[model samples]
Target: MSSSQQSKLIRVVQIIIDVIFGGLVFASGFLILWIIFTPLILKTSDISITASIPVAIGANDHPQLPVEVVGATGKGIRAAFVSDAQGTLQLETTTWSYIIISNIAKLLTALMLAYIFYLLRTVLRSIRAGSPFAPENAVRIRRLGYLVLLVSFLRPTVEYFAANEILNQLTITSPSILLPSPFKVEMILISLLILIVAQVWSYGLELERDQELTI
Candidate 1:
């Protein structure tokens, strides 16, 4: 094949790879938001929990709780809200709130991952062309890598607290001011997986950028 033809083929391949990678990242963000909102949607049923039921009728027993909502939007929006509830945990409380926050973080993280993947594909094309330094792209990729790392570091703190608090309450293993830990672990695991994927994509971009810069 002619050199020009070969370079064109390589660029086409890069574009294909980028499309697939970008799709995955986009789906990741959507999935994270779904995870966050699942509880709220399911909890549409009024959730009642007796912190302490009185044996006698007319016993002044009430369960007051603070609940928050967490989640992401299709267009890179993150949202959260709080409600004061009586006798039942609001849909806003429990893992839903944390899910919203986690998904929001995940949405941003997903964008970083997608951008990194794009950078990698570009660098691959540059490599094939024997024109090493794609300096502007490299710089941007590096910045995105750093941002991904920062987001990853923040995720554990955000994911774990909600999961741990709810799990401990449900399991009755700890007096944490949370409840109904049933789905906490699942939610957290999903978030962790997303974080890992985002970080890997980010680092991969960073490496590609470094290689291009060096060449």
Candidate 2:
């Protein structure tokens, strides 16, 4: 395709992504508000918190045995191992305020991601305007990469404590189970790629300045 055609196509695609990310940010905000206020408005005594846990059935003395028994006894003895002997634990809380507070890390991570997308949209706008090597764009790209790296590390820590709190709420006597690693190799790689692209943009900016001086 011609350069003009490609530019137009890219502009159209960027606009589409911008709109989608904007919508997602709006929805996330709404959900966060709902989570904060729902219990208060509805005067509900308990909010349900759900999480996955590994369960083994061979021994009745398993750490999750009490939870499993409580969950399954409601159905029948035969139905106890319905989830292939592993299942999710659901805890009800009269104190949802604390639960919401504990989950703020996840919400913050989501907000940061949305902000990154917003920055990306701005960069795309600059590109479409034929000024892709703007200094601010490089800074924004670098910031986006750093934020992704930060969230990647923060997620596991937040989830570990949150899961422990949930288990505590359930009154389960078992020790906190080791959660799976939340580190995503792909995310780290993508962050590094973005930082590299920012440096490339910096080099392009220098070249552009040199050409302008020559002209």
Candidate 3:
């Protein structure tokens, strides 16, 4: 595409980033207020917190509903269903502490995301100004990479602790599964890829300087 078209596309993307950044800021603020004061503000027993958790169903947990069977060929083998094991967990409590515990991770993630997008918007602004290889952008990109890595680990860690707190306050139930893992391989890979891109950006900035020097 021509430079003009590319500029327009970049501006459009920047606008989208701005929208997302605004939303994140708003959400983070809302969560903080709700966590700190909402319970005191709205005193009622109707409040319920809902979240999802990894779970496992026992081998015999399948529904007993009969279904049409084909001609029996091989012997039926016992099996069970496993997934990125997940189930919904809901708790009704008027206690403010539990509510805060349930939502703290979401708040942390949202604020981190807003910061990421803020860096992204600055990078895009530089690109839009025709200095796509600005040196500071390399630092910004590296910061973004590290921040994402932190988020990848931070999110699950916080969630695990928060959920564990709730679990500690309750009784155990059947069909148990492990809690969510602290490490998500895919997110780890993405952070590494971003770090690599930051290195590439640094190289591009070096080349930009060399080209200007040569001129």
- For candidate 3, the 10 contiguous residues with the lowest summed lDDT are 56-65
- The deviation in Å at residue 136 for candidate 1 is 0.8
What does candidate 3's lDDT look like per residue over 1-215, in tens digits? 99899888998999999999999999999998888775775475465544433322323332222333454345673443334444446666666677788888889999999999999999999988888898899999999999999999999889888877877777766544345555688888898999999999999999989989995
lDDT of 1 at 55: 13
Candidate 2 versus truth, CA RMSD in Å, comes to: 7.6
Output the number of the lDDT-best candidate.
3
True lDDT of residue 196, candidate 1: 65
- Which is the better candidate, 1 or 3, if ranked by lDDT? 3
lDDT of 2 by residue, 1-215 (tens): 99999898988989887887887698679769867775685475444543243223322333332333444455445644332243334434455654564556557767877887888888888888888888888888888888877777776557656655555555444543433344568888888888898888888889988888995
* Residue 90 error, candidate 3, Å: 1.9
**Which residue runs does candidate 1 get wrong by more than 4 Å?**
1-20, 32-40, 43-95, 98-105, 125-130, 174-215
Question: How many Å off is the CA of 134 in candidate 2?
Answer: 1.1
Best by TM-score: 3
TM-score: the better of candidates 1 and 3: 3
